[model samples]
Target chain A: MSERAKTPLIELHGLTKTYGAGDAAFQALKGIDLTIQQGEFVAIMGPSGSGKSTLMNVLGCLDAPTTGSYRYQGIAVGSLDTDQRSLLRRYALGFVFQGFNLLARTSSLENVELPLLYRGDSRKERHRKAVAALTSVGLATKLDSRPSELSGGQQQRVAIARAIVTEPGTLFADEPTGNLDSVTTRDIMELLTRLNQDRGITVLMVTHDDHVAATARRTVLIKDGLIESDLVRT
Target chain B: MIWNAFSIALREIGRNLTRAFLTVLGIFIGVAAIITMVTLGQGATLAVKAQISNLGNNLLTLRPGTGFGSRAASAGVPSFTQKDAETIGEQISGIAAVAPVRTASQSTIYLDNARACAVTGTTPVYFGINKWRLAEGRFFNDADLRSGAAVCVIGDTVRKELFGGEDPVGARIRIGRASCEVIGLLAAKGQAGMGDQDDTIIMPLSTLRRRLIGKTSSHDINQISISAQDGMDSNALINDITSLMRQRRGLGDNQDDNFNIFDTRQIAETLGATTQLMTMLLAAVAAVSLLVGGIGIMNIMLVSVTERTREIGIRLAIGATAREVLLQFLVEAVTLSGVGGILGIVLAFGLCAGLAHLIQVPFNFNLRINLIAFHFAAAVGVVFGYTPARRAARLDPIDALRHE
Candidate 1:
């Protein structure tokens, strides 16, 4: 409760998202109010058609809400243009998609350096930071290996390295282990948990699996287009 | 930032090297065609100008003909006499040298074998005006012109035909009832557009008038060759000679001069202008292919943008500005076409050299045209690449990520 007095990392007020127009319009989110503090591990869980993905997109700055105010570190995100939003995403945010979207035919080191490259980092800085990130993920020997040459778990690890290469304030993982086998999923979940606890990085993961949600310190459940329950674990 | 984009673009192109090369093939052919045509056309023009200039330096031929394209052999026009030539030589202000000439065919020559050949009769001034060089022995002096000596200078072709690699100097050959000594041999001048200038024999004008034509009444001559001094206005000299001939022939104003004055420089200029026109026409036609090649680049770039939609989405999601993405793809397009331009230049030079050799023309490399073609190809890459790059930049990241 004391966390509410401090400035939050992200805030959404009455956030609403809609698709199409007129009679064909569908509202994906309605009157959503959410807040995330620094160094918090939160999991958003929902069934299909429950608008959880839409909420994640807005939070990640990947999409703009139809009628809402989004603030990142107290700056209004909804007022920003596309390029401005991209700049925010480049500097302050990191995303891990379900499909480990590493550029094909590119070395893992190059994939990890992508975010820093957009920030106009020097080549030497980019290489140093990317190597450190890969080393943190225990993939130092696979720097030159391309995504095609790596296993599914290794590819996801490279994606994680890329996400953290910029030392982003927040990591948004949408079904990061959705394509992995049970063993690989467990290994990835353990890695995510270690990153959140050791580095104190704010992690917001969207998953339907209750077990995956259990690893997060807080669980948010959504039903229909609204948050049904919010629970904090000890 | 630009270096980053450039490196990315180079890597992407390297990833699909074969496709990139194939895509630029049209541009390659287009540039090569334009350069090859222009280079060869210029070479041919230069060759023609060289041949025309080789006919004579500052020379003009006065023949018995009316209007342009009239043959000197055509009847009805009166022939000029030695007295007329002497009058022009003494009266014209810029006349450097003048020679009255008489030509005759069917001269029987015997030098181990006899062959009928065309023989030209002229004074020592003919050698000076025409700039004919002696390969061996000495030319006819003033003594030969005054005494009407039966001495002749054999051309390269006549020497080859009759002498057969042997020195024909001091050898005696018979022309009709006259026996002439071969005092000199003229150097080879190769073939000219008009005819082979090196296939005839040269003798004294007086000797031919007396021995060949048997003109006992007057010193009748076929034509007169005149040379103007360097830096002199030949047109004024030509006008002066025209009025002189008209007055001598007793013709009134507007009677149409019966004699044709052919200036070698003027003929060269006219021929040069015609060849220049031909070169322009060829270049224009070849430029059409460059346009087609530009269209080809546009088509391939569009297809590439569509094919790389997922890649674009990834870039966008990773915080790459739309401008950066656009620049990356544009750089790739430019690299492809720029390489094509280089390859085209190489091919054009090789092809131009081979063709020029085959056709016996000079191979003139036009650096300006090559640079223009190269830069134009790069510009084509930019113009044609803009649409696809914009399309890729404007793509919705969400939709692009969803694209297969």
Candidate 2:
């Protein structure tokens, strides 16, 4: 417990998010408290309408909580403007989605180099780093392939390569393998487990599938926008 | 961030090549039209002005009576006879020379080869007044006019037309029912508004008077060409001529002068003003095309933003500021317009050359106009490209990522 006080990478307290205004207002998040420490692989699981997606948005820094505060690296992230939030997302969080979100009309190398591009890397440097990132995701031969040219599983791999290319502080993946076949899903889960154990990269994934959630070292269950149970899998 | 956005823009445009080209076409036509119209219009004006100035600074042309447009065929106004020419020569101060002219049209032949040609009857001074230089042989002298000799001087065009490349000097050519000898050949002066100077056959004034018209009149002198001495006041010279004409015509103190005296400078200014107005009108019409081009850019940009929503969301998630996103698409738009503007300049020159040939005006492809229009189109692209780029930049990543 004394070690838990050393400073978690992400700490949120009584966070609440609402949409619209007046009588049409709908609360998407309600009184949520969560902490994610460095080098911790955690999975969030919940049924539909449980506010798991909304919580993921706040956790990923893609949106701001209408109530309470979020501290990133001990700095209050809620105080930052849109630009800094974007910078935090780029430098601190690597995101992988079920849809992959790969840019069309672009190659795998360019996709992986995107985050580094915001870091002011030269074209030559961007190319070298993007190549290295693709290799890490077992896409060494598919650097020039556009998203449409690759299979679904391969495209998802390229997307994962893009997410982890920047070596971000935390990786936030929401249903990263939901769109993959059973074989591809197993391969992706193996990749995530290896990244967590070998690379020691912290991961926060949201998934409803028990098999997918079982790959993470810890799992947190949310019900009605509240954490109903937390468990560690050995 | 800027570079990231730029690549996104470049790739998007590359993906939609057809849309990109269509967007810049508007600017292309606008710029090209502007350049072509202005160049040809200004070139023609310059050519005319240069030719007129080449006629010399000391020259003046006088036409008889109040009628300005009609003069050559029949003297509708009172004729300035030998007596009036002598009087103006003697009384007008700072005057150089006075020559009375009569011109009639006839298609006569020497060797059965007949072509319609102008027969000009004037004194030997007509050669000097009109700055006609002799290419071969001598022009008519006082002896030719005094003797009413049937001798003539042929312009270069008529020399080529009737004489076919032959030296027509010393050759006999029929003029107005009387065969005359071609004593001299005038130098080639190309085409002018009055007609081809080289095509006219100039003869002794006495011969044209007796042979062509065969009638005498005191009220039918077509024109008077005057010249003031160098370093002399043209205004004072005009006043002297005006007063002399008034005295001779027997006008009262309150009566308006029957004849008109015009300044070449005034004609030049009026001509320039008309040309300038034409240039402005043409340029304004062409500018409308440029606006249409900007709309094209806006249209393509809107499509691009819609198509690349996911890309924009990804960039935003990866630390791209709105400014980066904006600049990326904006630069793409500018590049399209800039390339189109360059191509437009080349096309403008081509159109100018073609039109100049059609209208017989000197073609001048000016670089200054091209550069200005190039920059103008580029600016249009940037300004028009901003709204769509800004909108794309400000889109919510959460929403965009979720979009199908």
Query: Which candidate's DockQ is highest?
Result: 2
Error of 2 at B128 (Å): 4.1
Per-model RMSD to reference: 2.4, 3.1
For model 1, residues B11-85, the per-residue Cα lDDT tens digits are 889888888988789889989998998899989888888888787889999988685573444467778888999
lDDT of 2 at B226: 72
Q: What are the per-model DockQ values? A: 0.66, 0.68
The superposed Cα distance between candidate 1 and the true structure at residue B97, in angstroms, equals 1.3
Cα lDDT, model 1, residue A104: 92
Tens digits of per-residue lDDT for model 2, A123-181: 89888888987898799999999999999889988988888888887888999989988
Candidate 1 residue A206 Cα shift, in angstroms, is 2.2
* Model 2 misplacement above 4 A: A1-5, B1-8, B51-58, B70-77, B86-97, B133-138, B141-149, B164-167, B187-199, B206-221, B228-237
